[model samples]
Target: MSKPDKTSRHGERRRFSPSMLRRGMNLYPPFLGMGLRVKEFSDDWTVCRVELKLTRFNRNQQGTAFGGSIGAMSDAFHALLLMHQLGTDYHVWDKAAEIEYVSPGIGTVYGRFEVSPEMAEAIRAEAAGGDKVLPWFETELTRADGTVVARVRRQLYVRKKKSVTERERADFTG
Candidate 1:
């Protein structure tokens, strides 16, 4: 598959492959410390799977996964997935999140984040006029046996960047 159509702030093309992102995420200090691993990323950047293994560093008094670790494991993935899908022409950020813990993650918990083509297109269309669009996404944290451990809901803020001319006009008016 081809690389995503991403650009830097200077408008130059940038190469940020899914594999690179996965490697970086895995190496990140917080994630690494908590035994979190980005196990897989689809070539299209729409799907990401993360796993949190039970370890001393991430275990709580109950000998299960720490709540913070569970929350962190499911955080930012939706925004990251959407950012790559929307490219650099737009801004994407995590606006809010809520997690409902259904069960203690005894051994290992898995979470999958996905932003379908239709969802991406809808966000793009909604924000095409330079207005901000807030979209909510939901997923489940499950165990290897397919038992649900937690439910995660995330909201993202997306907006199209203003054209150079528009920025100049706003600057002059101000």
Candidate 2:
């Protein structure tokens, strides 16, 4: 028996590729039970597309996609993207989230989450000095024909870890 390597080929902690992330998410119970599938993840980790299909298991009693399923589909992507982008040196968490039910979802509904380069850069810069930064991201769940069924907003808290030297410097400056 051999121990599994936790580091990537580059000697850094193994970073989850889009495919890997999708596969792992599919196995998660909440998503699995709801038929939420990760349809796509961009190579750069900037974009993620998720879809939920209406079925007996996931449909509401009124015969539409369940609100809980829609909300679950909206969760996690923003934080996941930021965590990978920021790497091991930073802490990223989903501080808050809100979802608005705009209309009933029918058939297959899609949700896409994207973080622009500018937004990523802004988060990095804001957290570089060891201060917490809150960044908000929004996405919509839509039907196959592009009718929005819901809107979701997520706010993330991010902060860079301070090294001993940086901590000492801050202490002296204070």
Candidate 3:
């Protein structure tokens, strides 16, 4: 896997391509411990698919997937997706997140996070004037046979970084 690109003009944290992100995430200690695998990432970074296999280390007392594992599997992807979509000019963070357990995940469970072009456009428009935008995204975790196991809702805060000129103007105006 290619190293994360460090080409930002301002020398801030470098932006990672999908492949790099996938590889990095797969090696993350928490994810690795929880049996969470980043299965796929779209070239444009709009979609990220993750899987959690039922392993003895991750199973609950009931011999099913643990709830915490379920929630962990759904975390981070939405924020990562938006961060990549918005590029280096913006800051993206996970404002809030929630998960509802609908059914017990028996075997392998998968979660997919996708951001549409319209959603990206809307976020860009909202943040163009230097205002923060809070957008919501939802994803479902399902078993291989299409049994719904959980639904996750994530709220993200996105804001465009003000240029030096814009900051100066704001300071002057204020």
TM-score of each: 0.91, 0.85, 0.86
Report RMSD for candidate 3.
Answer: 4.0
Positional deviation of 72 in candidate 1, in angstroms? 0.7
Tens digits of per-residue lDDT for model 1, 1-174: 875546633354646767888999889998889999999877776899999999999999989999899989878888988887777788999999999999999899999999997899899999999899999999999999999999999999999998899999999999
Candidate 1 TM-score, true structure as reference: 0.91
Error of 3 at 165 (Å): 4.0
Model 2 C-alpha RMSD vs. true structure (Å) is 4.9
RMSD to truth, every model: 3.1, 4.9, 4.0
The TM-score ranking, best first, is 1, 3, 2
Candidate 2, position 162, lDDT: 89
User: In model 2, which runs have C-alpha deviations exceeding 4 angstroms?
Assistant: 1-13, 164-174
Q: Which candidate, 2 or 3, would have the higher lDDT against the true structure? A: 3
Considering TM-score, which of the candidate structures 1 and 3 is the better prediction for this target? 1
TM-score of 3: 0.86
Name the weakest run of 10 consecutive residues (lDDT summed) in model 3: 3-12
Supply candidate 1's per-residue lDDT for 20: 83
| Superior candidate under lDDT, 1 versus 2 | 1
The pairs that clash in candidate 3 are none
lDDT of model 2, residue 73: 91
